[model samples]
Each structure stands twice: as structure tokens, then as C-alpha cells.
Target: MIADQPQQTRDPQAPKGRPTPKRSEAQSQRRSLANSSSKMSRKDATRRQREARRADMARQREALAGGDERYLPARDKGPVRRFARDYVDSRFFVAEFFLPLAVVILVLSMIQAGAMQTYVLLLWMLVILLIVINSVVLGIKLKRQLRKRFPDENLRGVVAYALMRTLQMRRLRLPKPQVKRGERP
Candidate 1:
């Protein structure tokens, strides 16, 4: 009789005895929020690792030095500072402004003469002399103006130094090999 009796199955409509594990959106939000901070993000973790490595290296350096600190040598001041001078020598303000104008005038005078005149050499020489003399005077005036503005500053030298530096650049002392020239480790 027992062998012939069929086993009874659990009712399909009955609820499960165990508690369900489903989480609500609010619960998931809370869990993710907590995890976002608790779990070190890749970026933060990498930064922390780098910082630790740097500290370790610094400590190792100090230990190797046996407490003796090494100081780096002072770098050279620029050429501009080394060669600074007073600028704006005021001796030739009129000449500075008039040199160009004088050339223009000389050309016009030559044109007016309409022939190879007797004064050509004189006019040409006059322009050249004016240019040279006025240039010197201009340098002086520039120096004077610089003195007035800066007072304590060496204006003419500064101006000259600045001009020279602007026109030229310091040469590089060494050539760096290109990365592609050797195998990158």
C-alpha cells in the first residue's frame, strides 16, 4: 500500500518560507553611495600610491645622506642684468627725430636741383654727419629720460641691455638626444 501511494507535492500557490532578497531602488542607492566613498576609486588609489612612493623615496634619500643636506648651486643672473647700463642718453633728441627727416629733405633738395649739382657731396655728407651726431645725441636724451622716470635706476644701460638681449638669445649649451634614437625601457 505504501509503494502504491504517490508522494504529495508542496502547493504551487503557497508562499516561500524564506525571506526574499530583492533590494529597492532606495536601498541600492544607499549601498552604492556608501560604496562610492568606502571603495577607493582607481584615480584616488593611484594618487595615494604615488604619494606614498614619493614619501618612501624622500625618506630613503635622507637616510642615505646620514642627515647631511646637499644644497644646489645658485644659477647665474641673465646677461641683461650682468650687462645693464643707463639708457636714453638725451644729447641728441633733435638729431634722433631729425635724422630721418633730414635724409628726406636732402633727397628733395637734390631733386629740385634737377642736375648733377655742385652740392651733392655736401648734401650727402650733411645727411650722414647729421645721422651719426644725432644718433649719439638721441642716445644721451634717451638716457636722460630714463633717469627722470627711474631716478635711481640706470636707464641708458637698461635700455641698451634690453635692446641687445631682444636682438639675441643665449646659446643652448647641450644637445639632447631624441627619445626614438634609443629603445625606451
Candidate 2:
């Protein structure tokens, strides 16, 4: 009876607790997991980067429109610059008319008459002189005002900045005028 009992067999390559997986099967599982994780992370990073860029652009536009100070560009930031901008915005300057006057003079000079040509030249010279005088007066006044308002602040480029701003048409001014014309700086 003992000799008639059936015998049991086990696979030599398999472990005691589980069957051994094929090398190809193991590699495929790892590759699938890594691909899924990397794709998700890469997509998330791209979305976050896009959001940050959009927020930055919105802030810049707001600053350009004079709506917020936090996003103002480096050149336009600071109290002194703000004051100068306000000062220039609050008044009308004769220099603002220079472009239109020059255009008119150019058209007049194009006429065939000699006398008209001479008159246009003289008019152009006169307009230039007036603009120069106006700029000088504005520079002096702006310097005094800036000194009084920001005594501790550096006045180095404030005058020049203000003068350049004055030369621009009011509507075209960047960091568009926060204060209305005739308003106190």
C-alpha cells in the first residue's frame, strides 16, 4: 500500500510562494508605470507655466494702464518717477504741438511759391525756438517741484525724464496719466 501512493512535483524555476514572472513582463510593467507618471507630471508643469505667464502679462498691462504700481516696469517705478509722471500729465505743454506744427510747415514749404517757402522756413525756426524755450522753462519748474517734493530723492534723470514725457503727445504717454489735467501733483 505505501509503494502505491502518488508523488507530488514542483517547478525548479518558480519560488516557494509565487510563480516567477518572465523578464519581458516585468520590464513592460515598469515601463508603463514610468510613462504614465512622467506624462502626468509634464502636463501639469506645462499648465502651471502657462498660468504664470498669463498672470504676469495681465499685471504688466494693468501697470501700463496706470491701474497698479506693483507690476510697473523698472524704469517707471518709484515715487519720484510717479511724481514726475503726474506733474507732466497734469498740464499742457507747447511742445506737444510741435509735431502738428512741423507737419503744417512741411506742407507749406512744398508749395511752388518762393515767398511761401521762405515763410515756412521762418515759421519752422520760430516753432523750434518756442519749443526749446518752453522745454527750458518746464525743466526749471519741474526741478524745483521735484526738489521740494522729494528732497532726499536723486534728481539726476528726473528732469530729463519729465522733459521727454512732455515731448510725447499726452494721449500716447505710457503709464497713462492717472491724474486729470490741471490736477495737483
Stretches off by above 4 angstroms in model 2 are 1-51
Model 1, 10-74: lDDT tens digits are 56655574444557966898888887885558669989999998887676555333322232111
Choose the strongest candidate by TM-score.
2
Model 2 lDDT per residue over 1-185, tens place:
58788765676767574687789999999999888777878899999999999999888988888647789887788999999999898988888887888788888988999799788888988988988998898899999898888899888898898889888888888889899999988
The TM-score obtained by model 1 is 0.25
- The total of clashing pairs for model 1 equals 24
Separately for all candidates shown, the number of backbone clashes (residues 3 or more apart, or on different chains) is 24, 0
The candidate maximizing lDDT is: 2
Q: Worst 10-residue stretch by lDDT in candidate 2? A: 8-17
Question: What TM-score should be assigned to candidate 2?
Answer: 0.70
What's the distance in Å from true for residue 16, model 2?
52
Query: Which runs in model 1 stand beyond 4 Å of their true positions?
Result: 1-117, 154-185
Per-prediction RMSD in angstroms?
A: 23.6, 13.0
